[model samples]
Target: MTASLVSEPLDIASIRADFPILQKILPEGQPLVYLDNAATAQKPRAVIDKLVEVFEGYNANANRAAHTLAAMIDLELDAARSKVAALLNARSTDEVIFTPGTTAGLNMLAWGWARKFLKPGDELVISLMEHHANFVPWQQAALATGATLKFFPLTPDGRLDLDRLSETITPQTRLVALTAMSNVLGTINPIAAIAARVREVGAVFVVDGAQSVPHGPVDVQNPDIDFLVFSAHKIYGPTGVGVLYGKESRLRELEPSIFGGNMIRSVRVDGSEWADLPARFEAGTPAIAEAIALGTAIDYVQAIGLDRIAAHERMLTERAYAGLSEIDGLRILGPAVAHRGAILAFTVEGVHPRDLGELLDQQRGIAIRVGHHCAMPLHESLGLASSARASFAVYNTRDEADALVNGVARAVKSLRRKRS
Candidate 1:
């Protein structure tokens, strides 16, 4: 069903039923309260069934053969591309390239574009709040090309310091890569505003949308984003598949990073010609079933409506924030609930995040992410070695949020008492 066909308000109970895993009870004899959405979301039955259908019915190499199974796979792959393009409001399906995951997408750009284009005096700008996937690739690109790498500092509350954009994204800036929503802080960056600035400076803008795309709507055309990358597993789809969206012009500028079977137009002894827009980047036989199931996942969310999901998750985040705030020594990261998505990361004065995570899981089957969360720089900026994170999704409820807060409070008290 299309977004236009979805008019009914979200029925939380019915929506939760779509994900079979939510109904599961842990080995500890407690119902699983999954709050690690920032890592990955549980797959809905629709997506799971799609995967089964693809593998069972017609599993063949896409865009490679003229046989019936191959034709079916080709059709499904094309449909999935169209769905992704529509979701991003991309100008064309040709702009969407399937990859292994978000990490591969970012690495493709860093190697294909940055390493190829950036020179000694050129600068690449990123933010302190970037995931390591967004951070390390740019660092490598800068190191290889002798380009200067700069970081956009964060405000005291963990939001990007847009005021310093002029200084960071200068005329010499070749590219600016950052996360749309921070995995750790949950701070939602103003992508349109940032894209506009990057456009003004004639620099390529790449948004790591792994955290943002699952939570809300993202239009690639509005402010003219040069590139955007996100994963399927983070949005209730199967893992090992993701999308990289690039403007046609921007995509044309980069050489294909991965070279293999399907990506070549013609091969010769001396040189080779690349295939068209998407096929040029998708080099090998991809995760066929996973990519197809991603389309189903998209359908599931669009049917429920992103606006409703955002609203529900916002309410959960607020409930979690308020409850966690009441704890004496718990310090929540990032801005107020109004400025962030449905993620709450925090550090308690006397309790370690690892101990807290263990307690929550062992006692209440409350699954949360702990440690630096692959964002060591952001944690260091906050003067913390690690923090515990509870992220909400559409399947999550206020009760689960309360459970997290209460579980954390109890864990903190227990741990602190043991320390004493």
Candidate 2:
């Protein structure tokens, strides 16, 4: 289903109560104001309780044995897969393959698909704002396959220059990889528009949804996205669990990069037959507890509704953007709030990001992400060594946004005084 901005407000107080960490007080006696959502989000009670239930109730190897405990675990695993498929609006549950996280899923595609299919004279296109998880794999793939790697230039406002699509994606372009939302710039790319362009050139479209899936609704079928990847930890679920979604036809074409137990249909001394669609990709023992807990996380998010969450985050992002803009010599990255998600990354003149981060945490207990945020290329492109980023979530508040701004202002004053 397509997500539209909703006018109904979220009960931020109620939502905050679901996350126990939000109530944490720092050692310095300041209440925590967490704004580092782009890195990872705090877990809700529902998700945490699910993890406990999995371990305490029926801990067994999923889909491996016929015993009662294994059967129960298998049921939970299937439910989680169904939840992820429903979340992404995938055509089939088999389209979703479990990975350790987004990084593993991307690496699987690079090694299994790109390295296998790409050859010399072929072009692989990616954007400049990709996180290292998305960028490094393709760079390595190109190096191995002798394929030419090309980049989509960004607009001055840090958006992919869609106007140059024709020039970038040509007949020789075999694959186009891009992020649905930038972790560093918080710029939301037009996935559907770009997917259509990739289809026109008969190129595979891979979307890194690590930062976008948690914030809004994503229908993979609507965009006809060939492949998509995202992490559970970023969506208030347990870490070490992620999803790789591929079109049924596309997945069948990809050779499984990883091989081991549970991923094989039959094995002989000389050769072994691969398992069905998803199982073929999911090798070894999967993250049983984390994957199951991810279903609960999806249940929690779906209960609140993504449209409502998006609208709430938009309001907070706008508030933070306006506040940060007022700071002297502070330059916020990416486009206006309307063009981006609920993230604010800015660099203050003569103020190191690490120092500001330390002051915010030690003094104000305001948690924000600093440094390149795993997007060193994006930082380099912006001509910055690092930036301080404050990303919002559904549970965040106007007061928290204010705290970030006020804390930054205070930290800037202190840091500037020391510099002088």
Candidate 3:
């Protein structure tokens, strides 16, 4: 949809109705309870319809077209960039570059940093609680540049140890790549403090904002984030589209990762000059349709208001945490604290998380994520191979939390009876 379908402006019920898939049924003859929003949120109809509209209405490659459809596509792409820049409080829309997803964005940063600023024995600091996307890229970059990769350890309560963090940054530190929030632990990191420490070492700070931007307010300027990346799919938008936001100063210093059509000014017989700020990073044909759809998603979110959404999610999280904690033989991971973000991770005694997840689906149609949740280091710190997660979103309710607790209790009882 080019515009939202709400009759009265900014009504959440009217807005929720715009999401077609929210009404789907599950195999157990129960209403589907989607708790895996942390992995990827369901798209609203506005986003889906916009994708169709762009593809069927004016499908064309961006930035290279003299044709009408190509111009239309480029216009949509540019509007999407402007929306994203506004979301991040960026100085200019040109600061935002579209990539495949957060993984591609991180790799782009790693590639450019490794090629340009890295030197032998220089240090790059990250946290123990990073997704593999954030962790592996730095490792590869270190290998390629002969830089040392340093990781800050976590505190017992699932927070970053700030003392060690202060100690870790040194004159040798060139870059610090870390997640703004832990995907598995659901811990909202102290970004301002981290950025401050990074400044003392004269290093650029990059945040993997894949999880943070989806859940709460994100101002890149407020965080002093030199560079940040997040995916559209995780934020109630479409897959195959992501954004990389960089400070203009830092971006000017970075080398282009990919060399091709849209990224070039002029290609000589022997060499080439790269394009400016964002276009330099965005190499070839962009995902125009998906980018436009993401802009639609941004509109959808603003209509509902992120502050209200965050508050509602925290309420649901508190109810769920209380329900889960009252049950025996279960332990919550992360900080078992209230006023936390909208994710919950926990392990059950004598039950495999996979089995619990399968049973929850088969018996109650409840969807919960089960596994390391891509933060293996956090799980290892908790001495868990895998844990069950029931994440919250705008559509989730207190009733859904009740059903989840009762479902898990039933599973535990059944397993115990078998043992008896």
Candidate 4:
């Protein structure tokens, strides 16, 4: 396929070779067409090799021991944080904290920071299209703190309706938490504009970058984001590890919620002193090898370039949108192709999402996500119980998208015939 605007021509064949999983052959010799990137991306060989090296070469606990292995592991861990900070254009390495995933990071901020600042009658704003990861934490925080939770309504095309921003985000709103992009709808939110409004109200802005960061560039410093959360696995890194970026001042203001061995500077009988910025939040032993491997994954993506990756995915999205739009009863659930990312969530008239998904996988080895996509509120708002989703990534190809459309058409035809 030709490259998109502002992007260099990508040798997709060479790029696909880096991912070993892409070479898998199905039972009927069908090649796997992975379209579930919105959930978790497939890892590259470089990241895989790095993980093996970390485990075999230096398997030591970091920050506590004085041994050579420990020192080496600590350096690797620091390097990982530095790479992540650079990726997000964070002001300082100290501002970046490691967590299990985006869910853990959001939960940490909600329970630790929001609960601390939120009071009765205070308001917290979120969007209806948020994944449950970003939604439930704030909901529970509001319930616990007696703060009122407000939702920003969606436009007809699934974009956040920020026209009444002042009305939705009142002065009483202590915090505004929303996704940088919808995991279900693929709608990229205007974060900088939203941040400005949240700042106008003198409230904290927390961005769930679980979807956006992996697909495109995210400069936290430029956006004036107070807190940002994203997972490693979504960016072709290892699972079980994520990053949380907070402004240094903001991070220092809130106390750490999770307490344990490494998080404390001093543990006295009377009280305990917390460690500095990042260490304060990282309580237990971190995912040592996984974090280091995540650094390698970042390296892998940066080498290809984020702009090129995004451009490539956008092209694929355009192709997929055109193909899927032709199906007789398929109804897409997002903005136009120009406004959205590579995700396409839609419902077929007479087919259950699971049935469609199973047919795609079983018949053609086309792997697509089906169901609420962890955005039950978004589906409920859209008047859909569930929908099939095809999300693209850097490694996805034009032919794979066509295969998905063809499989869907065949499935719809057969399912309808059986009903008749």
Residues 142-163 of candidate 2 have per-residue lDDT tens digits of 9999999999989999999989
Residues 133-220, candidate 1: write the lDDT tens digits: 9999999999999999999988899888889878878999989998999988889998888888898999999999999999988899
User: Candidate 1 has which clashing residue pairs, if any?
Assistant: none
Among all candidates shown, the one with the greatest lDDT: 2
Candidate 1 RMSD to the correct structure: 1.9
Quote model 1's TM-score.
0.97
Clashing pairs in 3: 1-50
- Candidate 1, superposed: residue stretches over 4 Å from native: 1-9
Predictions in order: lDDT: 0.92, 0.93, 0.84, 0.91
lDDT for 138 in candidate 3 is 92
Model 4 residue 188 lDDT score: 91
List where candidate 4 sits over 4 angstroms from the true fold. Answer: 1-5
lDDT of 3: 0.84
How close is every model to the real structure, measured as TM-score?
A: 0.97, 0.98, 0.94, 0.98
lDDT of 4 at 143: 96
lDDT of 3 by residue, 1-105 (tens): 222332223344565577687688876688788889889998888898899999889998888869999889888888988999988899898789899999999
Tell me how many residue pairs clash in candidate 4: 0
Q: Which sequence of candidate numbers ranks them by lDDT, best first?
A: 2, 1, 4, 3
Clashing pairs in 4: none
